[model samples]
Target: MQIEVLVDVKTTLGEGPLWDAQQERLYWIDSFDGRVFRATADGREIRCWDVPQKIGSMAIRKDGRGAVVSLARGFHFLDFQTGDVALIADPEPDKPNNRLNDGKVDRRGRFFAGSMDTMEEGPNGALYRLDPDLTVTRIDDGIIVSNGPCWSPDGRTFYFNDTWSGEIWAYDYDQDRGAVSNRRSFAKVDRSRGGAADGSTVDAEGFLWNALVYDGRLVRYAPDGRVDRIIEMPVKKVTSVMFGGPDLDILYVTSMAKPPLPRFPGDGVLRGSLFAIHGLGIKGVPEPRFGG
Candidate 1:
C-alpha cells in the first residue's frame, strides 16, 4: 500500500476524520486541543474551527450543513460557518468526570455516543442513542472507554469497542427498529503488543478496520473474526481510520503526537499528522448522517 501524508497540522490528539463527499472535503477533530479541522483532499487550504469544549466525535447532519458534536457533558449541533452551537441533550449531569467519546450514526439515522470517565477510574460510562425526535436512550452500560461503532455492509451486524478491556463486541442489529441485541465477542486486542483499540470503520466487504492506538498500526478483521490484514504506520498513537475520496477507495488515518515516550522509539516524522493510504483494492460505504 502507498501511504501519503494528507495534512501536517500536528494536532495533539487528531481523530474523528469524516469525509463530506458532496463538498469533497475532510473533517476531523483534535480532542485535546478543542479544535476542529477542515481540509481538502490534497492538504491544500486547511481551516480550523474552535468549539467550546473538546469534541471527541461528531456526525454530519442530514441536510449536509454541519455536524452534531459530542462534547464534554452533552451533545450539540454545531454550525459549520459560524461555529455556533445549539444544545441537544445532556444525559450525564451528575457524572462530572465523564465525557462523550467515539460515536457514529446508525443505519436508522440515530446518533449514538459512549461516555467514559476521563480518569478511567471505573465503569461509569454508558452508550447512548439520540433519536431524530430529540430523545435520548441508554442502550449499553458498564463501559470504561467506548470506541468502534460500525455496521456491517448489510446493516445486520453492529460492532463496538470497549477500549479499557481491549475487546470488540458485535450485536445483531435491527435497522428498521433501531435495536441491537445478541451481543457476542467479535475480536479482542492483544495488549501485550502494546496497543489498545481505538476508532474503527467498516469497508464495503464488511471488514472492520481498527486502530491499535499505541501500536502504530491498523488491523482489519473479517466478518468471521479473522485477522485479515495489518497496516503498520510510522507514527505511534494511531487514533482513527476512515475511507474517503470520490470512489471511497482512499483510506484516511489520524494520529496523535503523544509525548513523554514514543511507542516504537524512532524519529517519528509523521507523528500527529493525517495520513492517506490508497490502492488497497477496498472501498468504503457512505457514513450515515445524523437524522436529527
Candidate 2:
C-alpha cells in the first residue's frame, strides 16, 4: 500500500526537512522562496524566516541556531529566533556559478555539505566538510547534483547521491578521524522508472528512504539495495524527506511545486506541497549540533 498523506503545505521548492527532538518541530527550506520554515506536525501555522540569499541546506546548531548555506556568501549563521544572519565560511570564492546544496551534520557534530553548479552547466560543484573549529575542507569533487549524505545507524557507512547520475554511493566513514573511504555503489536507480533519487534519509532500522524526484514517490530500500516499500506522493519533485512527529512514525516530505508541465497534464495541481505519510515506526536521529 502507498503511504497516505496526513496534510499538505503549499511550499515552492521545498527541501531539507529536519526534525528537532528537543523542540519536536520540523524545519525545512524553500529554495525558490529564499526562506526557512518551522512548523508543527499537523501542518498548522508555519514560522518562516527570510534569508538574504538562496539557502541551499540548513541544520540546527548546538546553540539552537541555524547553520545555513548562503548561496554566494558561503556558510552563514542564522539566528532562528531573531532572524539575524552572519557569515561563517566560504569555499569557492572564484566560482560564482556554484552554491552549497544538500548537507547534514554527522553524529560527531561535523557538518558535511556539497555544492552544485548554479549555472546548470558548471562543474565546479564539490562536497565539503565543516569542522567544529569553523574550518571547511573539500572532501569529494566532480559532483553535478549532490544529495543524501545519510549515515547508517552504526555510523560506519555513509550514503550519498548524485541525482543527475541516478547513482547513490556509499563510503566507509571514520568517526574519530572524520574520513570517508572505500567509496562504492550503494544503489543505481533507473531514471525511466521515475526520476533519480533526490534527498534521502536512513531510518532506525537502517533502511534507506529515498525521495524519487519527478516520480511522485519515496522508496525504501533494504541494506542489500532491494526496494522494500514504496510510498506515493501527490506532488513530484520531492526534494527531501525526514522522520518527524511525536514518535517519528510520521514521514514528512517536502516537494517542489514546479511549473506546470505543458505537455504533461495534471502537473500544476500538485506542485509545491508538503506531505505527511503516517504509520511508519521509524525515528530519525536528531541532527547533532556543532561542538555538542
Candidate 3:
C-alpha cells in the first residue's frame, strides 16, 4: 500500500502517535519542539498546541477532559481547551539528565511510560507505571533510550522495546495486578539498517507494527516475531505509528526531519511529517484511557 502525507508540519523529533476514539481524532507529539498536533481521519483540519515542555507522550483521560501528558521531568494534566498543564508527579527528580520518552496506557487503564538519558549516554533510563490512584511506581531499570510500550490483543503479553538495547521483549502480563513477568526476547532489529527500534502498535490480527527510525521502514512482525512485511517510506527517520479513523483502519505515522548537514543527502527532506495508510485489511484496537 502507498503512504500519503497528511500534514507537512515538520518537527525536530516527531513521536507518540495516539488515536482518540471518543473524539475521533489523532494526536501526536513533536517531542523535541514541545508541540502536539491533532488531525481528523481524512487528513484534514490540523490543530497544533505548544506544550509547556518537551512532550514525550499522552494518554486519553477517562473523565473526558484531556490527556495525561509526560514532560521532561514528570507527568501532568493538560487542559484540552487552554493548553494548561498541572503538575502531577516527577518520577525522577534527581536524574536531571533523564527525560520522559515513549509511553502508552495498558488494558487495565494505567499509564506506563519510561525515561531515558538525553545524550543516549548510558543505560540510565527506566520504565514506570502510573496507577489509577495517582501514585507512581518504577518497573525496570538500566535503559539508555526507552521506546515501544505496546501490548498484545488478548492482553496476555506486554511488549517493550529498548532502542539502546536493540531488542523488543515480551512479558507475561497480569492485568489485574498491573505487572509483567517472565521477560523474553520477542524481536531483535538489525540496527545496521541505519535506525533503532522506536514506537509501535499492535494490529487486531495479533501482529506488531514497528517503526525503524532513520531506516525509512515500518516492519510488521507476526505474533511470533517473524517479519511479515516491510513497507518502505519516503523519509529516513520513521518515528512512530498508530491506527485511527472511524473504523480504526487507517494507519497513521510520524517521522523526523534531518538537520542542516544532512547525514544521508536527499533523505529526510519529507521527514518530521505525518503520513497515513489505508485499505490495509487490518484493524486496530482502541487505546485505553488513563483511568485516573
Candidate 4:
C-alpha cells in the first residue's frame, strides 16, 4: 500500500476524520485547537471554523447543512454557514473535570460519545447517547479516557475503548432501542508493540482497524479479535483513522504535534499532518449521519 500526506496543517491534536459521501467532502477536527475543517476529497479548497471550546468528535446531519459536535463540555449543534454553536445537553454537569471525547454515529443515526477526565487520572467520565429527538442518555460510566467508538457490520455489536485502560470492549447493541449491554473485553493492546487505542472503523468484511496512539501502528483485527495486519505510520502520535475517498478505499489518518507527557516522549518531524493510505483493497461502510 502507498501512503502520502494529504494535508500539513500541523494540528496540535487532530482527530475525527469524517467523510461526507453525499457531498464528496471531508470533515475533521483539531481537538485541542477547537478548529473544524472541511475539504474536498483531494484535500483542496479547505474551509475552517473555530469553536469556542475543544471539540472531541463530529457527525454530519442528515439534512447535510451542518453537524452535531461533542464540544469540551457537552453536545452542540454547529452551523457550517455561520459557524454558530448551540448547546444541546451536558450529561455530566456535575463532573466539571471531565470533557467529552471520541464518538461516532450508529447505523440507526444516533450519535454516541464518551467523556474523559481532563487530568487523565481518574474514571470520572461516562459514555452517552444523543437520540434524534435531541434527548441525551447515559450509556456507561467509569472511564478514564474514552476513544474509538464504532459498530460491527450487522449492527449487533458495538465497540469502544478507554485509552488509559488499554482494552477494547464489545457490547451487544440494541439497534432499535439504542442501548448497549453484555459488555466484555474484546481485545487488549500489546503495550510492547504499540500504545493505547485511539480511533477505529470497521471494514466491509467486518475487520476492525484501530490507530495505536504514541506508537505509530495501525492495526487491523479480524472479527474474532485476531491480528489481521499492522502498518507502521511515520509519526508516533497517530491519533485516529477513517476510510474516505470517493470509493471509500482510502484510509485517512490524523495525528498530534504536541507531546502529551514526559512518559510518551519523542515526536516525529512529520507529526500533526493528515495522511491518506491508498491501495489497501478495502472499502468501508458509509458513515451514518445524525438524524436529528
Per-model root-mean-square deviation over C-alphas: 2.0, 2.4, 1.8, 1.0
Candidate scoring better on lDDT of 1 and 2: 1
- Model 4 per-residue lDDT at 179: 98
Return the TM-score for each candidate structure: 0.95, 0.92, 0.96, 0.98
Q: What ordering of candidates by TM-score runs from best to worst?
A: 4, 3, 1, 2
Local error of candidate 3 at residue 129 (angstroms):
0.1
Q: Which model is ahead, 1 or 4, in terms of TM-score?
A: 4
lDDT of 4: 0.92
lDDT of 4 by residue, 71-97 (tens): 988999999889999999988888888
Candidate 3: stretches off by over 4 Å: 259-266
Stronger candidate by lDDT (2 vs 4): 4
Give the per-residue lDDT digits (tens) of candidate 2, residues 118-204.
Answer: 654556688888887888888898987778888998889999987777778899999997889998988888678557788998888
Report lDDT (Cα) of residue 136, candidate 2: 87
Q: Which stretches of candidate 2 lie over 4 Å from their true place?
A: 1-9, 70-72, 259-266
How high is the CA lDDT of each candidate model? 0.86, 0.78, 0.87, 0.92
**Highest lDDT scorer:** 4
Candidate 3 accuracy as lDDT: 0.87
